[model samples]
Target: MSGYEKTVLLTGATGFIGGRLLLRLLDQGIKVRCLVRSAKKFEAMFPGLDGVEVMEGDPARGSGLSEAMQGVEVAYYLIHSMGSARQKGRGFIEQDRKAAENFRIAGEKAGIERVIYLSGLGEHQKELSKHLSSRQEVGKILASGSIRTTELRAGVIIGSGGAGFEIIRYLVERLPLMIAPMWVNTRCQPIAVSNVMDYLLGCLTTPETAGRILEICGPEVLSYRELILCYANIRRLKRAILSVPVLTPKLSAYWVQLITPVPNGVVRPLIEGLKNEVVCRDNSIRELIPVELIPMKEAICTALTEVEKGPGGIPSRQSCFLHSLT
Candidate 1:
């Protein structure tokens, strides 16, 4: 399977990370087939892009997936169940498990050679949050099939329109004085969205990534509290953060709902997940990809610029800003 000759089937093509990867692949003359739920919505977002194919399907239902996997050399599984809470009930873990099983069966039936999955970084299964646990479980389900699986576990993705960045940005911009939960003190390693895309694209060509569970992150590590302060300083806003130890996840979610635009479902999982420190434990991926990571300040600046640009989308030259920094 040569890099230039592979036909990659990408799920979650309209998502924050997936959308960026799709454009990069297309630009490199890689054949990309996207599995999207709504063709109309996909067309609305993409609006006449050449050299890409879209197949209408739902990964959750296992419908229309087989057709999309046909003749696929490598399939990128970027779909997550966070936004599907209402439709799948409050326990998203079970929903994720079922979806992964379906995807595995479909991939095997279609003879998919490799399956690349993007997941979250967390401790061992016993100490994992429901969200992080579900991500790991999904990786296992994908590997159960004969197809080789590459699981890239990442922490908060720093990019405009990304849920993590949105939360950090809104908190910094909206509050002059904040009463944050103790989880804010937990350490996290964030990777720029462009860096994430770089690893994803690298997996397509790097056979060493197959059958490996790799953790990816930026050059620096900081506490969630420090991240908020950094963002505040970037925008030149005066702010004071007070971390309260007694605030439970439930209480924190409610407070976030009141203070920010983040919904309860999204905020709840995020808050629960933030209690654990999320720094990379190994540098194996660095050896594999061999690209210098973007600094935190530069990543935040690029994210802010994208948000201010009205989500009309980032220009191609701007898409790989972090790549040049590397």
Candidate 2:
């Protein structure tokens, strides 16, 4: 199928994963319309990009959704409220739910062919953490819509600008000896950003992926403590972690804030979620999308390499296209 033949609507274009996916779609020559709250900002980000357009809209506020979804074939739902969860209090949950419902209605009304959503991986039990629960709930809401939905539940996404990776980066780069909570022992399957994007793009062409709840994760499963140690090792920094039961989630968040670029609000729920074992429960996505998955160490190395190049490491879509031409 020709890229021009496929029309895709993308949400969270300003976010880490969405931003990368935007470039990928443009590179593949796919027509993309971004649902952004500020068209000015979006335009500023991709001034001369071709085969792409921006629709001014807000998903959380439930405005401009219908107009944004008009005539789109596939919609990528990457919006989440975790960033504003603390500021919104418990109301963030309701905000996320509302946004999902609005997107569902808009997509259904627009007759979208497929909706691809990136969600978190966790046990479907009452004991799931609030953050994980919200992720899963959004998946459910999107799946309930008239269109077929492909919800990819991922663990910690290792990337340059990702929140989870930032937390790991700061903790390792700043501290040599860490007083960690017991949750540090919790195991998670971390996938590289490139691999995640491949799976996401693969979903667009893989008709069998629709209406499926797929788990995309790294080949290696390691504890949070192990990941931190791995990060330290890659930097050639000797580190030791003393896992203790005394540090509460709030205290851990404050400690993280002191060391990391992340704020206390965003880190709190993330820290709390470390207790849940988030390794992949299923791996059927491998056969569907045969991209070679990056290992934890290699993923960390790539992320660090990009980070070392400064904020401009990740190129804008227009810049990428220009570079390709050169």
The lDDT values for all models are 0.84, 0.84
Identify the leading candidate in terms of TM-score: 1
Cα lDDT tens digits, model 2, 122-205, are 877538888888889999998996789999999899999899999988787778899998989999999999999999999998
Clashing pairs in 2: none
lDDT of 1: 0.84
Clashing pairs in 1: none
Q: Tell me the alpha-carbon RMSD of every candidate.
A: 3.8, 5.5
Query: Where is model 1 more than 4 Å wrong at Cα?
Result: 1-3, 85-90, 311-326
- Could you tell me the TM-score of candidate 1? 0.92
Cα lDDT, model 1, residue 296: 85
Cα deviation of 309, candidate 1, in Å: 0.8
lDDT of 1 by residue, 42-98 (tens): 898899988889999887788998899988879999988775644546467777788
